[model samples]
Target chain A: MILPGDLSKIRSLEEVFLIRFRLDKKSKVPLLLVVFGVMLILFAILNIVLGSVRISLHDLVRVLLRQGENAVYDKVVWDIRLPRTLAAILGGAALAVSGLLLQIFFRNPIVDPYVLGVSSGATLIVAILMLTGVVLEMGTIPPYLLSVGAFAGALAVVILIVAVSGRVKQVVTLLVIGLMIGYVCGAGTTILEALAEKENLHNFVLWTMGSFSGFGWEQVSVLAVAGGVLLVIAYLLCKPLNALLLGEDYARSMGVNIKSLRVVLVLIASTLTALVTAFAGPVAFIGLAAPHIARLTLGTSDNRALIPATILLGAVITNFCDLLARILFAPVELPISAISSLIGAPIVIVLLMKRRTSL
Target chain B: MNVMQTKELSVGYDGRTVVADINLEALKGQFICLLGPNGSGKSTILRCLAGLLAPLHGSVFLKDNLLYQMDPGDLSRTMAVVLTERLSPGLITVFEITAMGRYPYTDFFGHLSREDEEKTWEALRLVGARDLAERYFNELSDGERQKVLIARALVQEPEVIILDEPTTYLDVKHRLEVMEILRELSRKKGITVILSLHEIDIALKSCEIVLLVKNGKILASGPPEEILSEEMVAEVYGIESAHFSSCLGGIEMSNSGGAQVFVLAGAGSGAPVYRLLNKYGFSIITGVIHENDIDYYVGRALGGAVVGEQPFEEISLSNIDQAASLGRQAEYIVDAGYPIGSLNRRNVELARRLMAQDKVIYSLRSRQEFEALYGVDGNKPVYCPNLGALAQRLSRRKK
Candidate 1:
C-alpha cells in the first residue's frame, strides 16, 4: 500500500498547505522558523527600498557596504526610515497578538486588540491635552507625554471593562458596553476638540491620524522591550487561553485561575496595545486583524504556531501597508489605519460570510 | 476515598437557592446519571461539583480535598466539565481543541510541551477521533463534536468528568454513541463520569447509579433497577408508565397513549375536517403515508396504522404494516375538515361509506384546533369533550 509513486504524487497547493500545517511537532520546525527569519530580512530590505525617495537595490546595497558616494541617501535610509519601519513591525505585531488574545478571551471574533479600550482611552487623554492647551517647550508635541497619557487611560478602561464584562457573561453584551465606552470617550474627545483653540485643535487632530514616522530610537526601544516581554508572557499562557476558549467553566474545571488569568492576560494585552497605540496613535486593525489572518492561514490557535505566524504576518503586512500609505496619496501621505482597514474589513467580512454559509 | 463528596450543598442564582441537598458520597469510577425534568437544578448541581459554581451553604469535596479551598488550577487538574455552551467562533482545529485540556500543566504562555502533545494524542485516540485531528472543530458533526468535547476533557486527565445533558439535540443514534463514550471512559479509564440526560431508558441502560433530582431535593439515588421504578418515574414525570422486563434482564417501559393521530391524511384542506374531533379520549390514527414524510414517524410513535409502502431507503419505516392495518379498520371516518385532493380514494371512500352507513359526518371549518381531541368521530362517547356535546345543546337533545 505504501507505494513510491504515491509519495511522488504532486500535491495541489491546498493539499501542500494542509500537509505542512499538520506537522506542528515536526523536525523541520527550524526550516519553518527560517522561513519567517527570511521574512524579517526581506522586511528590512523593503523598508530601505520603498520610501518617499525610492532607492534602487543596487544603490541601497552599495550605501550599506560603504562603497557608494550617496552619504545623503544613507542618512535618509538608516537614520530616518529604518527605525520607523522597525517600529511599525514591532507595533503591528504587538497590537495583533494582543487583539488575538482578547478575542479568544471574550469568545467574540469581533473583539479587537483595543478591547482593553487603549485607543479610546488614549484618545481621551489626548483630547484632554488638546482642551488644556498643554504645550511643552518643544515645537513638536513630546511623544513621551502622549505615551504616558495613553497608558494611564488604557489601564483605567481595561480594569472597568473587565469588571463589567466578567459579570455580564455574554460576549455580545460586553462588546456593546466596550463600544459604548469607546463612544463615550470619543464623545468626550469630540467635545474637547470643539472647545480647544486653533493650535491645540491642530495638534489633537494630527495625533489622532496616527503616524509611525514619529517614533524615534528611544520610543521604539521602550515599545520593543515592553511588547517583547508581554508577547512572551502571552505565549506562556497559550494553554490557559486555549482552555478559556472552551468557556469560563471549562477553564475553571481545568484548574486555570479564570479570574486571575483573565486579569493578568488583560493587563498584558492592555500593555501591548497601550504601548503601540501611545506611540503610533492607535494603528487600528494591526492588533484586530493580523491575528485572524495568521489563525486562518495556519488553521490552528495553538500559540506555538499562531504567535510566530502572527508576528511574521503582522510585520510583513504592516511594512507593506506603510509602503502603500506613503505612496498612495503622493504629496500627502495617508494614515497607516486606512491601508489596514481597506484590507482588514474585506478579510473579516469574508471570514464572517464563510462561517455563516458553512453553518 | 470517594472520588466526589458533597456536604449539605445548596446551589443558587445570586440569593435564591435552586439545588438544596443534604450529603452524599459518590463511589469512585461509577457512571452516574442525574435525571430530572427541565429546570430542576440538575445543571446547577453539576456545576457545583465541577467547581464552576461554589455551594452557598455546604462544602464540596473532590477526592477528599475541600473544593473551594483548592486552587482553580488544581481543581481543573482533578475535574473536567462539559456544559451545553456554543464555542467561540474561531479557526481552531480539533488537535488544538483537545490540547486545551493540558492548560493546567503548561506555563502561562500556552505552548504544549512534549508531554502535553502526547497526552492530547492519547486522549484523541481514546475517543476514536484521531483522524479528525486536522479538521476544524466547528466542521465536525454533532456526534463528532460530542466526542471531541469528551476528548478535550479526557486530556485534562481528571479524576472526574461532569457533563450536563450532553444528549440534547442529538438524534437517538448520536445520543447512544455519546453515552457509550462516557461508559467507556468510566469503565476503562477509571474516571468517575457524571452526566445528566432526558433520555430515561438510555440513562438506565448506561449508568450504574441513577440520581433523580426533583422539586429542590434529591428524589432517589441507587442502582438503576432499585431506583427507576414505575411509580417513581410516574411520580417524577406525571405520565402513565408501564415497566416490562426483556428476557435478557433488560427493563423496557411499555407504551402510554398519546395525542398523535395518523390520518392516512390527504392533500388540500380535507385533513382538517376530522381534526375537529377534539376529545382527549377519542384517539387519532395514521394510515398509508408516503415514505420520507414527517408525519410517518409521528404516526408510528403514536401507535398508528398504515397500509402502503413506507419508503425504506430515504426515510425510516417503523411498523408501517401495523399503522396501515389500523387505518384499514378506521370506522366512523371524518373528512378532517377539508376538501379532498388527488389522494388515495380509500380514505375518501371510507368517509363516504361511513356517512352512507348513518355514521354522523359533521362539516368543520378548519378542524386543526379540534384534532387536539383526536381526528375521529365527535358523536361517540370518548373520554373528553367534542363539538357533538355543544351541538346537542343547540338541538335541545341533552338526554
Candidate 2:
C-alpha cells in the first residue's frame, strides 16, 4: 500500500524522467508544442522559398508585407507557392488528426482514413466526376461540386463502415472489411477511367497520383475551415476517446453513448479525410504515420497532449515532404504521395520493428 | 428498501433472450454472486444489470427510478462495472487508467480535478495497487491487473459495482485476495457489488447472496446457506456424479472404485485418511465415530458409510455390531489410532473384532505399538506408521 508520505516520493521519481533543461515536468507538453509550432512555421517558410524558381527569403518577406517591387515574384509566392505550402501543412495536420481519431475510435493502431477506405471512397467519387466530364474544369461544371461529391461519397462509406462496425466486434475483421470495400471502390474507379476520353484520363490519373500543386486560395480556405472545425470536434472528444481506449463496453458503461459517439467520431474523421482528399487528391501515409510519430516522440498516450502534438508534427512533416517532392527532380516534380510514402513508410516500419511484439 | 431491483428481466442479443424471467432485489451494501456454469448467461445478466444491455422484457429499478429510463450521466455516477475481459492497456499508466473512472464527473475535456486525483489514488490504495501507479498497465501481472481494474471501479465511487468472473484467470492466492477485497469494499463502504463467479467454494464463503442460474433461468436466489445445497449444485452445474459439501465449502467426486475399507477413527485423526481413500476411488465405511467428531463431517462429505455414536457416549452395542459386520465384509481395516479413553474403550474392541478374522489390518500405529497401547499381545494387528505407509501396503496387496 502507498502511504500519503510516499506519494511525494513516487511523484518525484516520475518528475525525474520529465524534467528537461529549464522546463519543469509539468511544462513538457507545452514546451514540445512551442518547439513544434516554431519548427512548423520555419518549414512552411522554407517550402515557400526553396522551390525551383529561387525567390530570395528577403523578397518573399517583402512580398508578404506587400511592399515588394517584383510583381512576378510576388505572384509566384502568393498565388502559387504559398497556397501549395499551406495546403500541405493544413492537409497534413487534418489527415494526421483524422488518423488519430480513427485509431482511437476503432481502438486499433493500424486504422487510418486510408485503411478504413474513407479516402478511397472520396477518390472514387471524384474520379467518376472527373473522368465522366460531369466535373469539367471548364465553366460547364462548378469545380466545388466535386468536393461536395467527395464529401458525400466519403460520408456514405463512413456510414456503411459504422454500421458494419456495430455488427462486427473484432477490430481486425473490421479492417479487413474496410480493405475489401476499398478494393471494390478501386475497381469501379478503374472501370470508369477505362471508359473516359484520353485528355480527361490524364486529369484523372494526375488526381489519383496525389499532388498539392496548383492549390488555389479558394481550396486552401475550404480545407482550413473544414479541417479547423473538425479538429476542434476531435479535440472535444479527447476524454471519451480515452475512455474508448478501454473498449466499447466500458466506454458505454461510463455513459459514453457508444452508438452516437461512434457516428460522431466517424463523421469527423470522414470530413477531415474528404476535405484533404478533395483538394490534395488523396495524399497517402500522413494519416497513418503522423499520429504514430507524435505518440512515439511524446512517450505518452494522453490524447489531450497527443492531439495537438500530432497536428504540429504532421504539418511539419508534410511541409518537409512537399518541399522534397517539388525540389527532388527540379523541373519534373514527383507526386506528394510518392514522397510521403517514401519517407513515412520507412518510419512506420522502423516503429513496428522497434515494438515488434505490440503492433 | 432495495437499492437495486430487477423484475422479470430478460437479456439477450438480436431479439433472442439468453437468460429470461430474472427477478432480484439487492440492498445498498449487499454482495451478490451470480453462480452458474459456463454459457449460463452470467456475463449477460451482469451486463444487463450494469445497464449495458437493455432488458428484453422487463424493467430494472435503482432507488425506485427505472434503470433504462435514467439518464446515462446519472446512471454512471450510481454504478460501475469490472468485466472479466482483459483490456489492452497500451502505453497508459495505472494512474491514468484508474482516473478514467471519473469520466462521468469530469469536465467536457475530462481533466482530472484535484479531488478526482485524490479519489483515484485513494482507490488505488484501497485495492493495494498504489505502488503500480507509475508502471505501464500492460507490464503488470494478471493479479495486479485485476486489482488495478477493481481500483478503477472504486474510483467511480458508485453506489453499486458489477464484476463478471473477475477471479477466473487469477491464481488461488489472488482469487482469495480479490474476493477478500470485494467483501471488505461492500461491507465497509456500503457499495453494492454484483459479480459472476465460477468458484463455488469461494463464492459460498465471500458472497452474502447467491443467484443460481442454469439453462438460461435462475433456479434460486438467497443466502448460500439455504440455496447452495449439494442437490442444487448438482442440478445447476449438471454434475450428476459430484457431491457438494456446503459445510466444507467444497465439492467431491462420487466414489467409483469398489475397494472397501473400514476405518477405526475418532476426533480429527481420520479426516485426512477419509479424503485420501475417497481420492483413490475407494468405497469407504468408517465406524464408531461421535457425531461431533470432525472426521464425521469429512467422512460424510466423501459419501462414506458412517457408523455413528452420540457425542461423549461410549461406543454403543449397536455401533460395534454394525462395525463388525462392515469390517468382516471389507478386504482390510484401517485403525486410525484415535485416542482411547474409558468412555470410548469399545473402539479397541471393534479393532479386535477385525483382527480376529485374520484380516490385513493397517494401523497408523505399529503392531507392538498398538498391542502396548490398546490390544493384547496374542491378538495383535499389523500396523503401518502412517497413511502413506498404509496406502503403499494396500497398493502392493492390490498388485
Candidate 3:
C-alpha cells in the first residue's frame, strides 16, 4: 500500500521531464544545437563571402537580398557561390544523415555509405557515363541523367546488400561484403578510366576526387527537395531506429517490423548518398565522420536528437571545409575531399581514442 | 484464463523442425519455467511463442486471437520479451531504455506521456532499480542490467512476459532476487511469467509449473512437485552420477570407489558430514536418522547408505542392528554429536556398543562430553571439535 508521503513523493511531470532529460545532461543538447545553428549560419555566410574573388558581406547580402547589386558580384554570388554553398550544405547534411542511418542499420559505428560501396556504385555508373562517352555519343547529355544513373547504381548495391543482410546475420560478414562490393565498383571505375580519352580522363578524375564547386541552381533545387523529403522520412523513423539500437530481436519484440525497417533504412541511406555523390562527386569523410561528431557533441544515441544534430553538424562542417578548400590554395582550388579528410580524420581519431568503449 | 496457448506447434528454422508437436498453455498469473540442458530447443520454443519466429506447423493463440494474425503492436501490448542478448546501446540511460517499452502506447515520435512516465517509474520501482534510472545502461553490472531489462519489460504492462535465461549471468543473490521479483509480478500483477531456464533448483522452488524440454520435445509438463522426480530429472538431463533430490530440491554428485565411513548421526547432524565425505571421495553410511530429518534427505541425495527409522519414532533395535552391521563393513565410524533426546536416547547406546566392539569412532565432542553422553568410563572415541578438525583427522588417516 502506498502511503500519503509516497504519493506526494511520486514525481510531477515537470520533475520527471527534468530527471529524464538530465540523465544525459541533455539540457546541453539545446544549448549545443543553438551554438551549432549560429555556426551553420556563420559558415554559410562565410562560404558566400570568401570565394576566390572575395566578395564583401555587404555585397553578398545585397546580392542575396537582390538590392544594390554590382553585375560581377551578382553574377558570381548568384550563379556560382550561392548554389555551390547551398549544395555543400545539403550534400553534407544528406551524407551525414545517410551515414547515421546506415550505422544504425548495420549496428556498427564506423559504417557509412562510402564504406558500404554505395558511393562507389554511384561513382562507377557516373564514370561509365563520363569516360565511356556512352551518353555523350547520344548527342546531348540529359541534365538529370547522371543523377538517375547514380540513383540506380546506388539502389542496386543497397538492394543486394539488403538481400544479403537477410541471409547473413553477422554484422562483420555484412561489412566485409560491403567492402568487397566497394572494391569491385572501384575496379570497374579504374578500368573505365584506363580506357577513356585524355580530356575525358581529367574530368572523370576530378569527379572521382570529389568537389562542391560548379553546382547549378537546378541541381541545388533537386538536392534540396529530395534530401529534405528523405531527411523528414528519416526523422519519422526515429522511434523504430531507437528501438533498433537494442538489436533486431528487441526491436521486433517491441512491435517494430524489422524486414520493412531494414529495407527503408537502406533505401534512405543509399538514396541520400547517391543524391549527394551525383552532384558533389562522392565526397568523403563527411558521411563517415559527421554522425560521430553529432553523437559525441550531443552525448546521446536517441535518434530523435541525433538525426537533427547530425544534419546541422554535417552542414556546418561541410560548409566550413568547403570554405577552406576555396581559400586554402587560393586560385588552385583543392578538392573538398582533401580538406574534409584533413579535418574529419583528426576529429574521428580523437573521438575513437576518447570513446574506446563506444562510438 | 489462458493468456496463451500453442496447438501442435512445430518451431524451427528454415522449415527444419526443432521442437515439434508442442501443446502448451500459459494461464494468467502462472509462473512457468522451461527446464532443460543446453541446446534443448527451449529458446526455439520461446521464440515461436513470442512470435519472433514463425511456427513450422500449427498455430499459436493469444487469448482468443491467432498469434500470427494479430498486429505487431497489438501483440506487443499484450506480451513482452527479455532476451539473452547483452545490449550495449551507447549512451542510453536506464530510464530511456525502460521507457522504450512504451512504444506500443506512445505516439509516432515516441514521446512519453505523463502516464507513460508514471508507468516507467513504477516499473523501475518494481524491479528495485529506481535509483539506477539515471545511470547509463552500459555502465551497469550484469545483475543491474538484468533488473533494468526486467523493468523495461514491466513498463510494457504486458499480460505475459517471456524471458530466455534471464538469470543465467546473475550471482546467487541476484538470481534469487530476480526470481522473487518475477514471482511477485506474477502473483501481485497477474502477469503470466514464462521463461526458459537452466537452473533446475530455482525452477523447482519457484515455478508453479515446469516443462522438461529435451531433444526437440517437452518430455513432461506439470506442477514441478508432480513431475520433477529424481529418475525423471536424471533421464531428461541424461545425468548418470548426479541425483536430484525432491526433498532437498537440489542435485548432489555421487562419487564411486571411495573409502567407506559409517556415520552415526541424526536430527540434521549428518548432512554436512555426508557432503564432506562425498567431496573427499569417501562413501558414506549414515544411520538411525528419522525419515523426516533433513539429514535423511541430504544423505540419500549424496548416495549415502542411510539406515533410517520412522518419523517421530524411537530408534528401533532392528534399525540399530542394521546400522551396526553396515558400520562393521566401514573402515571408520563418525559419531555426529546429536543431543540425546527421549525419542533418540538409543543412539548413545549404539555409539557405546560400536566403541566396545573395537570400532574407531570419530566424535565431534570432547572426551568428557562423549563419556557423559554415552555413560562409559574406560572405552573412548577419538574426539574432534568441529567438522574442520574431523576432516583433517580423516585426511590424515587416508594419508
Candidate 4:
C-alpha cells in the first residue's frame, strides 16, 4: 500500500502507475491482445522444451504428429512432457476463469472456485477407488469423469451453504462454511485412505500428486469441450454477474434474472473448476491468484475484460511455473501444484494489501 | 389516475411483512417523496414497486403491467434504481459504472451501442459528473459517489426511477444537487421519480408529492404543502404540536418574520431540535458551550453567536467579564446542562446570569431556577420532547 504524494486529493495510483494504463478506452484489446497471445505460445514452448529429455523442437513436433517413433524420444515427449504441458496451460486457464466467476458471483475476493469442496470430492472418489482395489483401465475414466464428479460435489456444497443459514449472509460466513465443508469432506477421504491396501495406496498417491503424464489427446479433447462450454456460458452471463456485484436487490431492481443467472453461473464455474482440478490434481492457488492478477492488470469487473485477462494471465503464469518446476529438479521433476503455490501466494498478498481498505 | 400505482401493495422481507397496506402513486413526470421514521418501511415499499421485493397481499402495476410478471429485460428497460447499497467499489471508472446501466440493452458481449454510449455520457453530464467520467469510482468522495450512483440509475433508460435515501451521506451541496437532478430528470424525460428521504427539510423543499408512511401504510399523500400540513406531519412522525405560520410570536416583525428558531443546544442533543427549528428564514445560534465539545464545533458551523466559557485554567475574572457582557445581550438562554449538579461554580454563575435577564428567555430545570433568575412564577418547566418544541417556544418569545 504505497500512498501517493498527496492524501488531500485522495487519487488513484492508476494514473501514478501510468505505465500500466491508457485513457483511450476504445483503443484497448489491440496491443496487449497480441502480446498475451504470443506470451501463451512462448510459455507453452518453454514448458515442452525444458523437461528432462533433450528432445529437439523438430523431434517433439514430429512425435506429436506420430511420425518420429524413436522409443526413448517418443516416450519422453509423447508419454511425459507434451500432455503435461498441455494440461498445465488448459488447467491453469480454466481454473483461473472459474475463480474469477465465483469471486464475482459471491462478491467475495477469497471465494476460490475449489473452496466449495470441489477438490475434496475428487480426492474422496480417488481414495475410495484406491482403497477398494478398483483398477480403472487406462482410458476408462479419464480426468473428464473425475471433473464431472467434482462438479457435482461443488454444486452440492453450494446447495448446502444456501440451505444452512441461521447465520448471516456476509462474505466471512460464506467462507467459513465453505472451509468447513472442505474439512468435512477431507476427513471422509482420510478415513477411506487410512483403510486402503498397500498396492492400491501406491496408485492413489500418484493420482493425488496430480501429474500431466497420465493424459493424452482424448483427455485434452474433453478438457477443451468442458472449458469451452463453461467459458461461453460464463461470458453470456457477464452483465448479470457484474450487476450482482452491487448486491442481489440492486441486481434484481436492474432486471437481472438472479435465480436463473445464479444457477447457470454456479453450474458453469463448478464444471470449469472440476475439469481443471481433475486433470491437474487441484493445481494449488492458480484459481485464486490468476483472477486477482488479471483484475490488477485490467482494473474492471466487466467480465468481458476480466475473463480474457484472467485467461491470458492464467496461461502465462501456470506454464511459466510448470517450466520452472521441470527444469529446477530436471530428471526428477517436482509437482506442478507445489510450483503454483510458491508463486501464487505472494501475488495474492500484494493484491489483498492494495485492495483491503475497500469492498 | 397515477402513471405508477400500487393497489394495496404489501411489501416485506423473507416471511415478515413491513409495509402492509401501502396505496400510493406518482403521475408521469412527477417527483414523489416517501418520508418516514427509521423502521417505517419506506425502502420496503420502494423495493416492492421496483420489482425487487415480492408483495405479500397485493400487486404493483407499472404503466398497467404487473411488475413481477414482466420479463426482467422488459422490466429493466422501464425501471431503474439507486439504493444505499454497498458495492465492490472496484477500480472501475465512473464512465464504466454508468455504462453498466445500459446493460439491459447491451448484448452479451457488453459492447455499448452508439445510442447506449450517448445516453451514458448524457447521464454523467446531467448529474454534473462529466468531468469525473474518467475518475475511478471507488476513489471519489461520498458526495461524488452519490452523484455517480444517481447517474448510473439515470442511464438505465427507464420510464421510472426509484432512489432510497439519495442524500444519506451527502453534504449540503450534494443533497440539493441530487434532489435537483431528480427534479430535472422528471421534467426532461417524463420519468416518474420516487425517492425515500429522512431529510424532512429536503422533502419540503423539493418533492411535488409527499407520501407520509407510518404504521405499515401511507397515512397521507399529495403535494408537500397540502398533504404535508402541520397535522399530518405530527401524526406521521409522532411529533407533538406541528404547525405552520408566517408570523412569529403574533407579531409581523418583517415580510419574513417567523424564521425557524434554534435554541442554544448541547452536543448533538440539538440535532432534532435544530431540524425542527429549521425553516427557510430561521437562523441558527449554538452557544453556552465549554471549549472542547464536538457539538460546539457543529454549533460554530451552524453560524450563530456563542456565549462560550473560556478554558477552565484561563477562566480568570477577565473571561467571566466577557461572558457576563454577552449574556446581557442574549435573547434566549436554553440551559445547555453542562456538568449537571453545578459542582463547578462557573456554570452555576453563568446559569444565574442568563436566568437573571428579563429579555433573555431561558428554559431551566424548574420554576425555582426561573424564579431565581427573571423572578417569574414558580410554575412547572415545559417539557421539550425535541427541537420543534424549542422552536415554537422561541417563536412564541419573539412576540
Candidate 5:
C-alpha cells in the first residue's frame, strides 16, 4: 500500500532520468519557440541573399526598400529570390501543419501528407494537365485551374482514405493502402510521361523532380491565402487535437465531435498538401519531418505549443533545404526534394530511434 | 434522488444485441458495480450507459433529461468516464493530463482558468497524485497512471462517474486503493459511482448495489449481500467444484480425494491447516468445532467433513463418539492444538481416544503438553511445531 507520502520517496529510474534531463518542463516551450523564431529569420535572410547571383545583404536590403541602383540585382531580389523564399516559408509551414494534423488524427508518428498519398493525388492531376495538354488546345492553361484540379484530386483521395480509415483501424494497414494509391497515381503519371512530346515531357519531368526555382508572386499569393486560412483553422483546433492525444473514445467522452473533427482535419491537411503540390510540384520530407522536429525540440506533446513551433521549424528547415538545393550543384540546381530527403530522412530516423514511446 | 436511470435498455455493436432488458437506477452517493465473468458484456453495458454506444431500445435518463438527447458538452459536464484503455500520450505531464478533465468547461483555447487549475490540483490531491504533477505521464507506473486517469475523471466534477474495469491491471494493493478512492467519492462527495468489476469479493464488500450479468442479460440486480447467494455465484460463474463462502468473503477450491486425516481442531486454529491439507490432496475430517467458529466455515467451504456443535454449547458425548468413529477410518490424526476452553475440552478426549487406538497423530503441542493435557502415559502423538513441519511429515508419510 503506497501512501501519498511515500510516492515522492519512490524514485523510478525513468523519473530519475526525466529529472536529470528536465525535458518535461512546460517552461522550455517559450525559450524553444524564441530559438526557432531566430533560426527562421536567419534562414529566411540567407535564402534571399545567397542565391545563384549572390546578392549581398546591403544590396538585398536596398532592393527591398526600393532604393537600389542595379536593375539586375533588384529584379533578382524582388522577382526571383524573394518570391521563392516566401513560397518556401508558406509551403513548408503548410506541409508541416498538414503532417502534424495527420499524425495526430491517425495517432501515428510516421503519418504525413506524402505517406497518405494526398500529394501523389495532387501530382497525378497536375501531371495530367502538364503532360497531356488536353486543355491547351483551347488556350494556355490557367494556373488557377491547375490549383483547382489538384485540390479536387487531393480531396478525392482524402475522402477515399477517410472512408477506408473508418473500416481499417490498423495504422500500418492504412499506410500500406495509401502507398498503393500512390502507386496507382504514379503509374498514371508514368503513362502520360511515356507518350508526351519531348519539350513538354522535359518540363513535366523537372516539375515532378520538385523545386522552388520558378515560384512567382502569383503562386505565392495562392499559397499564402489558402495555407494561411488552413493554418488558422488548425490553430483553432488545438484544443480538440490535444484531447485526441488520449485517442478517439476519450476525446469523444470529453465532448469532441469526432466525425466532424475527422472531416475538418483531413480537409485542411489534404488542401494544404494539394496547394503546396500545385505550386511547388510535390516537395518532400518537410511535411513528414517538421512535426517530429517540433516535438523533439519542444519536448512536449501539447499541441498548443507544438503547432506554432512546428510552423517556424518547418519554414526554417524548408528554406534552408531550398538554399542547399540551389547552391550544392552550383549551375545545375538539384531538386529540392533530393536535399530535403537527404537531411530530413536521417533526422527523422534518429529522432524516432531516440524516442520509442510515441510510435 | 436517482441521478441516473435506464429503462428497458439493450446494448450491442452494429445492431446485434449483446445484452438486453437492462433496467437500473443509480441514486446519488450510491456505489454500484456490474459483477460478472469475462466476455459477459459488462463493458458493453457500461459503454451504453456512458453514451459511447446507443441503446437499441428504451432510454437512459439523467435527472429527467434523456441521455442520448443531451449535447455532448452537456453530457461531458454531467458525467465522466474512466475506461480500461491504456494511454501513452508522449511527453505530457501528469498535471496536464489531469487538467484535461476540465475540457468541457475550458474555452476555445482550452486554457486553464484559476478555478480550473485549482480543481485540477484538487482532483490530483484527491487521487493522491499531487506529488506526480511534474512527472511525465508515460514515466509513471501502471498504478500511478490509473490514479492519474481517475484524477482526470474527478476533475470533470461530474454528478456521476462511470468506470469500465478500472482495476483490471492493478496489483492487489493498488486495486484496493483505487476501489477505496471510488468508495469514498460516492460516500463523502455524493457522486454516483458506477463501474464494472470482476472482483466479486471487493464488490461484495464495497458496492451498495450489484448487477449480475450473464450470457446476454442481467441475471439479477440488488444489494450484493441480498443477491450474491452461494448458489447464485456458483450458477453465474459456472463453478462445479469451488465454493464461494460469503462469510469468508472468498472462494475456496474443492479438496482432492486422498488419504483421510482426522483433525482435532476448534476455533480458528484449523482454517490454515484445512487449506494446507486441502492443497496437499488430503481429505480432511475436522471435528467438535462450534457452529459459529471461523474454522467451521473454512472447513465446510473446502468441502471437508466437519463435526459440528451448537454455538456456545459444550462438546457433547454424541459429538465425540461420532468423531471417534470418523477418526477410526483415517490413516492419520492431527491435533490442531486449539485452546482448551470448557466448551471444547471434549476435543482433547477424542484426540486421546484416537491415539490409544495406536493411530499415528501429528500434534501441534509439545510431547509434555500433549501428555499432560490428555492424561495419557503410554500412547503418545508425534509433536510437530508448525504447519510447515507437519506438512513435511505428512508428505513423507504419503510417499
Candidate 6:
C-alpha cells in the first residue's frame, strides 16, 4: 500500500534501479543472500515433506516437532527420509563447492570432481573392497570403513596430481593428465567389477550408480561435519580463488601464495569429492553445473558471493534430484546420477548457448 | 633516489639462461622502456623484475631489500605487474576484475570495505575506464581491455608497475591511447613504469630511459636522446645505418637497389618521390629543401641524399652546386612541383638545367605547367600524374 508521498519516493528510486526484484539494487548482494537463504530453507522442507510415503504437511510438521502419533510413520520419516535428505544436502554442497574450486584452479568451466578422477579412483577402491571379500567379516562390514577407504583412494589421486602440477605449467596439460588418471582408475574398477562374486556384484553395481539411499545417522553426521569443515576452508579461500581467476601469474602478483593455495585447493576439493563418492557413489555434474547456475543467477564469479550461492544451489539441486529419484519409481529408487545428468546436462547446454562469448 | 635496481641478474627457463649480467638502476617516477627484437630476453628480464621467475644468479632490489627475498605481500604492495596474458574469466565485470588489485590489502575473505571500493573506482577512473565498470572484461575491445588491466594494477597502489609488451596487438590509435595513459600515470601519479616495447619510435618519444637488449644482455642503457643513435639502432636491430634516423624517430625502410634518381623537390613535395624511389629499388638524391621543410625529414630518413638550405633562407649557390652535381650523376630526374616562392625560386633554374641535360626527367606536373613554373618553353618531360605512374615509368627505365 503506497500513499502519494511514498509513490513519489519510489519514482525517485527508479533512477538507480537495474533489474527488478530488489527495492534497493545497490544492496543486491545482501538481497540475493536473503533470497537464496529463504529458497534453500523452503526447498529443504519441501524435500523432506514430499516422498514415496506421502506424509502430509501436518504430519511432516508433527514429525519434525517429534510429537507424531504414528510410530511406524515416525520411524520411516525420522530414520529413512531424514538421513537421506540430509545426505543429499551435505553431499550436494560438498561436490558443488569442490567443483567451483577446481574450475577456478584449472580456469576451466567444464571441470568437476570426476574430471580430476577422484570419483573413479574412489569407485575403484570401493569396488575392490566390496568384491574381494576384504570387508566381509561374518558377512557384514560397516559403511564408515567403506567411506574411509574411498577417501584414501581419492586422496591418493589428488596427491599424484599435486605432485605433477608443479612440473606442468599449462592448464590444459594438467586437465588432460587428470582425465587420463580418471580413465586408468575407471578401467581398473571395470575389470574388478567383471571378476566379482555373483552375490557381491549387486551391491558393487548399486554403489556404482550413485544414490542417497542407505544413509544412516552415523554416516550423515560424518558427511555433514566433514562437508561443513571443508566448506569453511573453501570460504576462507574465496579471496585467493578470485585472484586465481585472473591466472597464476596475476594471482602471484596479487600476493596469492599460489603454490600453497594450489595444495589447499586440491586437498579440499579431493576431500569433498571423496566424501560424496564414498557414501553416494560418484554423483555426476552437480559440481560443474551448480556454480554455473549460481554465476548466471547472481551475475558474478566473485567467489565471496559465488561460494555460498553455489553451496546452496548445489544442495537444493541434489535434494530435488534425490526426491525425484525416490518418487519417480515409487518402490524402487532410480540412480541419482542418471536424474542429475538428465537435468544437469541440458542446463550446461543452455548455458553454453546463452553465454556464447564465454564458449 | 633509486626505486628499483637489479644486480648482475641472470634469467631463463629450466636451466638455460636467456639473459645474463643485467645490472641496472631506475630512479623514482622514471618511465623506462626495454627495446629489443623478438626473443631477445626482454620478457625474461621483466619476469625477474616482477618476481614471477627467480633469477638464475644475482638479485633484484626494490629500494633496500632483495626482491626475491622480500615477503610476497610486501613486494606486491609496492609493485604490480601487467602481463601479456589475456584474462578470460567468464561473466566477470570490470569493476570486480579491477577490485582484484585490492587483494593484498583486503582482509581474509576479500570483502571490500568502503575505502577499498572507493579505491577500486578511483583506479578505474584513473585509467579513464569508469564507464567500463559494469561491462564484462572479455567483451571489451583490446585497447579497453588493456586499460582495465592497467587499472587493476593501479588499484594495488604500487610505487612501481612492470608491463610486458602491453601494446602488442593494438592498432595505431589504441596503441597511442595506451602509451598516453601509461605516460600520464607515471607523470601525475609518480608511479615508476617499466615496459617492453617493439616500436622504438614510441619508446624514444615516451620513455625517459631506454634499455636496448640484444643477444642475451643489456646492450646499452641511457636517456633515449643520448643512446638511441643511428649506429646503435643498426647494430641492435641488424638493419643498415641509413634506414634509421634517431633525430626523426626511428623511421626505417629496406633499400631498393635500382638506378640513381635525383628528385628536384622542396616545401613538402619531395617526400613521396623519395619514398617511391626507395620502394622501387632506385638510389635517390633529393635536393634544395629548407632545413625546416617536412620533405627533408622523410627524405633523409628513407636514406635519401638531400641538398639542404637554412630554414626560411634562399636557395644559395652552394646548394645549387650540390644539386647540379647530384643531378649530373643521376640516370633519372623527377621534377616534383614546388611553389615558386622567393626563397626557393632558384630551384626552377636547377630543374631547368637538369632538364636541358640528357637525364630522363619525370615530372608530376603537366607539359605546360612544368614549362610555366621553370620558365622553359616547349621542353616536354614524361608526365606522371601520380606516384604509381612515376614508379611505373621509373621501373620501365630500369629495364
Per-candidate DockQ versus the true complex? 0.33, 0.38, 0.51, 0.39, 0.56, 0.45
Alpha-carbon shift of residue B385 in model 2 (angstroms):
6.8
| Candidate 2 DockQ, CA atoms | 0.38
lDDT scores for all predictions? 0.70, 0.84, 0.87, 0.70, 0.87, 0.85
Q: Candidate 6 lDDT, tens digit per residue, B11-81?
A: 99998999999988988899999998898999989998999999999889998799988998999999999
- Per-candidate RMSD vs. true structure? 11.6, 5.0, 5.5, 11.6, 4.1, 5.6
**lDDT digits (tens) for residues A225-297 of candidate 5:** 8799999999999999999998887888899987778768777888788778877778888988999988976
State the TM-score, rounded to 2 decimals, of chain A in model 6: 0.88
Sort all candidates by lDDT, best to worst.
5, 3, 6, 2, 1, 4
Off by over 4 Å in 6: A1-26, A132-145, A163-173, A193-203, A356-359, B240-242, B258-261, B280-283, B288-294, B305-333, B340-346, B356-369, B375-399
Q: lDDT per residue, candidate 1, A126-193, as tens digits?
A: 77865565654556666687778877887778778767755665555767777788888989998888
The numbered model that scores best in DockQ is: 5
Quality of model 4 by C-alpha lDDT: 0.70
Query: What lDDT score goes with residue B57 in model 3?
Result: 96
